[model samples]
Target: MDQSISSLHMRKLCPNLEREDALDTVLEVPLPEEMFPNRKGGSSSSSTDQDNHYAWLKSQAFNKATDTPPPMLSGRTAELQLLLSVIGSPLIPMPVPFDTAFSNRSVCESSIQASTAKYILQQYIAATGGQAALTSVQSMYVVGKVRMSSSEFHMGNDNSSAAAAVPPSITRNGKSEIGGFVLWQKNPELWFFELIMAGCKMSAGCNGKLAWRQSCSEKSHASRGPPRPLRRSLQGLDPRSTANLFVDAVCIGEKIINDEECFILKLEVSPNVLKSRSASSFDIIRHTVWGYFSQRTGLLMQLEDSHLLRMKSGCSRISASTQISCKSINNDSSIFWETFMESIIDDYRYIDGINIAHNGRTVVTLFRYGEGSINHKRRLEECWTIEEADFNLHGLAMDSFLPPSDLKVDCD
Candidate 1:
């Protein structure tokens, strides 16, 4: 995706460059021999190079026996899984004095609402299955089915003619891939999640001290922030963990969701937390989450979150006067991308005295905007239905939660 985006930028920047020259400048590779073969005076060496290039391209496109997933589809699958894993996930916040007040009383009333949030959480705990029952559980296992679909994308920045000429790939109103996941969790930060869809697999887990994720498109990499809870926990699979997650959240008031009165608990990641997750070239500007708890049933009915990120990239500019002399243009300015996700939970079923949402739907939107790019948006939706669930699994162990040895662990 990055490479493709880079190519688009190059095309815009150097429209006058020949196609072969453009490929050479951007990809640092000669244009494909199929499209631009050597001419008349070409030597045997050039012919040999062409033959080798074609062979390499064929090899990349044709390995029938290998289990490696197709690059395009695999990349998309991995991307979808990454989006699902962090939909409404948040970082733990440091507690503040309840008596503290800010100049903007209405905007920063979290301190005053802390107690109310706690009381609401207690009610939630009691409603799910009292604290005693929740604390007694040490492990859990769940299996669920999901259907995911993505819509074709277009940028308003693109010309109307180009937009009209672009064939539709997929739409929000199109077919979806059906798949399922198996999840295992142990007390105090030990958990494993595996999702399989469209013949591609993605897995993530926590080994108490470290959290990591892996997929067909990428090697496993340790998470950036202090080990966060697995996204599955918020799906009503682990009431205890879910309760603890919002312990520091503030009651933002009540709202009617799906005809049911619900209390909204809101939590925003602190700047420090966002800083920890940011890379040198990318900044996580903001991440905020909200959970809607049913006032009548004291059950979680919906979860929503939004995140904003800014990334900076630099590209070189080639001069028409001297193709040999290239100048680095800070033209790679900062671009902001945002993602918003909302999940609606329903069909709650009692499993071992605990309320588990057997059916749910999640919709995610990714918006690309900021410097030099037109606002482009794409949407993905996933509906999940639980098929099986069991608590206190007997044989789940720390060994099963260990990060893969082949994975590279990011520095704290």
Candidate 2:
């Protein structure tokens, strides 16, 4: 064979061999018997056949071992692209107000006038009933509902998980039966709440005699429990009780400023009372300020309350201001407020009179603090209304509302 062609053939036969390495490695002798130890050959024809077979085998082995290509990563690359697209997409917006009237207040007296606490309380009182009528009622039955929303925000700390996990905002609708009993010289009152929501029900009833709770639900059978100490301390449904618990805390006083009627109240909650009420679970110290307003008419114009509650883990502060101006006294109005509460705030509204007083909005902001530079905050806005209200003069039985003896299982 020509020298160049022979070299090319040798290259093909030994693909891994290079010019420098080939000269020292290629053998000039005939095929060795050890290279084909398994071959059975002795005649001349078999010898020729073995040589050709060895050449072909060498070519096949060289191509298999030396010509293998690098792996293709197309599938892995595509998967990575898909993951990026999903992670980069826009997230669902939180349930916050896009526009609010209070957001644009300027630094002026009018701004202060609208947001003060005293204005908010008066509106709330008038919405329920006039001061005289509210005071006149010996007992009251308030049926309402409450809804809560929760969201997780990044703690932005090393100790936290790479992704923050937050419980889904659960909207719970339930019926709450509240009874206010007269206490303390017909001024203060005792209050009870029987709430059924999301298949979980808790009922609390208290008077000067006793305070108790009963939980009834599908997951847990009806059971009696102990009453919260604060509930026990509450005086009966009278102005004196109301004055002590509410009015005393938030100093209730009337004022007529520039013909625009306003009620100023300062609230100071006792830490000792909160600790006693919380028992062993949580320690809370709460203080509040209220502002109520009326435009000469008995109707409440607006009500606002600013509250601050401190605990061991952190603090929760809220400013709940409600404006109850437009008064439509009719069955439909009451129904509208009740329906609103069911849909947005609470699950139940007890029928009161033709007037509905529970239509209001609440904005709450929660914060969690940590040792490092870790802080989490959340804001929730809700619109609520009360539908039905009645008077519960027949006091609830104490034994009927106590926790069941079987519920001693450790809930913690």
By TM-score, who's the top model here? 1
**Which candidate has the top score in lDDT?**
1
TM-score, candidate 2, is: 0.40
Task: Assess candidate 1 and give its lDDT.
Answer: 0.59
What is the alpha-carbon lDDT for the whole of candidate 2?
0.28
Residues 39-63, candidate 1, lDDT per residue (tens digit)? 3422121111111211211112211
The lDDT values for all models are 0.59, 0.28
Off by over 4 Å in 2: 1-136, 145-148, 151-162, 165-190, 207-244, 249-263, 274-282, 289-291, 295-356, 380-382, 392-412
Candidate 2 lDDT, 1-412, residue by residue in tens: 0011112110001123455333222222222222121112211111111112111111111111112312221221111111111111111111111112123334354434334443453454454444555545544443333332323343334453212222222112211211111111111224444432222223444443334333321112211122222221111112112222332223356766436575655444455543443322222334343433344543333333333222221111111232222232111111100000111111212233313345444444444432222344433333333433445333333432344454332221
TM-score of each: 0.70, 0.40
